[model samples]
Target: MIVISDLRIAILGLGYVGLPLGLALSRHFRVFGYDSNPIRLRELRQNVDSTSETSSYTLEHSKITFLEDIKDAQDCNVFIVTVPTPIDSNNIPDLSALCAACRDIGSVLSSGDIVVFESTVYPGVTENICGPELESSSGLQCGSGFFLGYSPERINPGDRSHTVETVCKVVAGQTKGVTELLERIYGTALSAGVHVAPNIRTAEAAKVIENAQRDVNIAFINEVAMIFKNMDIDTGDVLAAARTKWNFLDFEPGLVGGHCIGVDPYYLAFGAQQAGHEPDVILAGRRINDAVASFVVDQIANMLRPSSRILVLGLTFKENVSDLRNSKVAELVTLLTQKGFQVSIHDPRAARLQAKAFYGIDLAEDLDESYSFDAVIGAVGHKEYRALDSSKLLRMVKNDGVIADLKGIWRAYDFPPPIRYWRL
Candidate 1:
């Protein structure tokens, strides 16, 4: 086994997960961050992170080098894979990115080297799926010529509290020595420490269940939201009263769109189906959450006046981040437009061209200067929008206009009594 102190490290696929991990690891080891996107490499070299996870100062202070070529990672003894594991159109786990990364890293795999995967996957994906790819591409024997590990990423984009170093890391390896080495290497930079699992499969299962549990919880809230809407009761008020009890988990209802929560459950459900076991609650939760986009649009149509001019605020999946992967906001806008309402979107952080290309919706550049609309929907709780004065937003709407607060960014008591307000 190679000592943790002597091993050179390379991180492949530098995005939100990989870039932050590479920056943190580079503080202690000789690190190289590789990506196939030349444009991304150039941006990182200039100390500009368009993802907004790592600032210019943080990237510059870290001793990490950005590389566009795979050869730059050849000499490293420890390689970490943090590429995205997105699902295909059929919602099946797409291993193409993982397979391609393995083939590239396997070409240069040497004895005593370890490759760790931080992408979320079903149990046994690292060993049963990725390990064989590494062996086949490198013409090496697993557990002898090369080894694998799993350390699932807990990165929450736009979250300042639970970062890479602060969050407790779960690390696992094929062998005991490999597990210990990874723990030691991660311990040097992670102040929150690490929990070493018994095996790679356990680590992968733990990661999948983490998001699945949240998906189920949010689905319950979404169902309640639909129920309360029909009953003419405020879901937020019900939650507020329920929270007076001792042990109530305060999960709010909104569009459950993002890479992790919306996509991770499918991976688990797929594995369960493959093993001849059916997942009822998991798939049911996904079904309810998936229909929420159209549900929101239906609510808006029922409330708005004829030929209403609507403004949708915050286009990103979450607040204060430009990442739009699997965003439900786009679906809501499409549904609203189909109902004959003219809709316009405004997101301070989302790129206009990117939104136009992905969703075919032109994002308004200036919110303050734009024309007033009959309805305003706060889709995402971005800080920039949160800082806006409620009076100004209320004024943007016509008399007796609706304010659909998906994230509940405004106070119900603060709004004028005449205006109709709805929150999820």
Candidate 2:
């Protein structure tokens, strides 16, 4: 309802998604970044980003105001909530973070203000759940007093290629005016473009299925990889040959972990089951991806004898990212360690204190150069580990030791005959 020239944008939950977005939005508007975590605020005050999503140069140079209390954003007319929407132990959508964010925003809401969400969630969440909470806390009607919008975040953490400036933003609102207002507001930081969806629920469905489709594709590849493994064939080699066709999808087989691809499908599946439909394919993909950790451990455990000294390279969910949230490497390490094997992990990018706090696994300060392992697993494809030569990999293992490459990073180079090379 306000002029676009007078835009006052407030970003909530300054984590991986919020930090980069806040910085980008600050380029066009007077941006206020708020977070409940004191440590995150302290780090940002010092121009330090623990998530590694934003550079020190970007943080130090940005004109955004980082705040600890929610009331500091009271002056802003537009609030963008970019909090996490994780699943519960039973894999149901946990809206605790999203609900809490709505309450925080509602407390400072005024008439004619607008609130948009960038957190990933099931369809109808914005209208059914968050809008009512905002109305309750603000003592105002949603459409009459304040407006609601949904612009699901497409932030691929640690990805420098498809950044906030490059990726296309999908925005939907309760009305055409709200949608057009969002298009102009978010379009300031985006050069790629903006897509105006038909409605809020359609936009929400589009976002959830993007990651869910990726999970299913990777699950197919993983299932094929398992089939080829039983046949004693190299999945990397098979993929290399199969990818010659132009129509072949470029999905690789590996442990599907991370915040988005690993978890978003369950959000979709839950919605399906609640509507009296069986989400057979969606749940199947989830089951296969979930079982990969234990399946990998079984192969390695069967290869080596009891009490084998195993070393896992890289601990984060993906390559070049320091994020340890929902890391399958940590899961594999726990499964291996529970079987009485001496498992040591080395990841140069991961935070040691956070890793211990999150997973109860203390990262070694440095790799044991004096000692070698019975097996070394390349869990993640970090550049440091990926750039290592074959000879260096050979040295980390004893004679006839195993080198399990989960990422298939070293599938091309052949190790010495004494080294038992295996790749998934």
Candidate 3:
């Protein structure tokens, strides 16, 4: 067995997950962070993470070296792959990014080296899909020439409480030596400790279902939200009463966006189908969650006049993150635009250039100080929008304008007058 302290680590895909983990691990090893995106690399080099997961102070001070070229990781003995696992247009799991990472990493693989995947994928993907790709690309024997491991990333963008260092790490490896190596490596860096899964596939399954389970729970709340609406009752009021009892799950009803919750369920369902088992409940949750944006739009349209101008606050998938990928707000904007309603969107945390590039959304600039519209929708519950006084919120909308509170952040506040509020 190789000495844990003697290991050289190369982290592939320096996004929301890998970057933080790399920074944390750098304190204990010779960490080399690599990403295919040169633009992201340039930003990281300047200590500016567009992802907002890392601070400039940490980025500048961390001893970890960031790299753009794949050849730079040749000397590293441990490779951690934390790339995104996205779903295609048909909602099928796309492994192009993960496969490409394996091919690149395989080119640099050496004997006794272990490639650990942190990306969220269905069970057997790391062992069956990635292991073969690595062997084929590197011309090496699996578990003989180089080994494999799985450590599913548990990163929640915009979440300050359960950070990479604070959350528990689940890791599994092909061999006992490899598993112990990971336990010591991650356990040394993180205060939350690490769990050794029985095997690599078990770790993968654990990560995939973590997000899928949340998706199912949220779907139930959303379905009931729609049901309560038909009964002329507010879901928030019902939830407030229901939450009085202990053990009541506190999942809110809202648009399920972002990479993990929206995309991971399909991976699980796909794996289930491959095993010849029908995954009806998983698919049902996805269907309900996916329909949330359209349902929100329909409710908004019903309350407003045709061709009414609506100013949407917060465009990111969640509060306090710059990521706009798979954001349901863009879908809401598109649906409203198609319905002949003029929609102007704004998000304090989202990258403007990326938003325009990704969704062609010309985000309304600097609407915080002064802006007025026929209606104002709190699409994302960002802190800035959350802290807005009731008078300020009144100023954002017309006297008879409706306030669509998606996350119910403002449900407790009493607006000045004539400003109606609605939330799921």
Query: Which candidate has the top score in lDDT?
Result: 3
| Model 2 lDDT per residue over 88-191, tens place | 99999999999999999999999989999999988889999999999999998999899999998887878889887789999998988899999998887888
Q: Please, what is the whole-model Cα lDDT of each candidate in the order they appear?
A: 0.90, 0.91, 0.91
Better of 1 and 2 by lDDT: 2
What 10-residue stretch in candidate 1 is worst by lDDT?
411-420
User: In candidate 1, which residue ranges exceed 4 Å CA deviation?
Assistant: none
Model 2 alpha-carbon drift over 4 Å, by segment: 368-371
RMSD list, candidates in order: 1.2, 1.0, 1.2
Model 2 Cα displacement at 240 (Å)? 0.8
In model 2, what lDDT does residue 281 have? Answer: 96
lDDT of 1 by residue, 217-302 (tens): 99999999999999989998899999999999989999988899999999999989988999999999999999999998888899
Looking at model 1, residue 184 earns an lDDT score of 92
Candidate 1 at 101: error in angstroms? 0.3
In candidate 1 the C-alpha lDDT for residue 227 amounts to 98
Clash pairs detected, candidate 1: none
lDDT of 2 at 373: 93
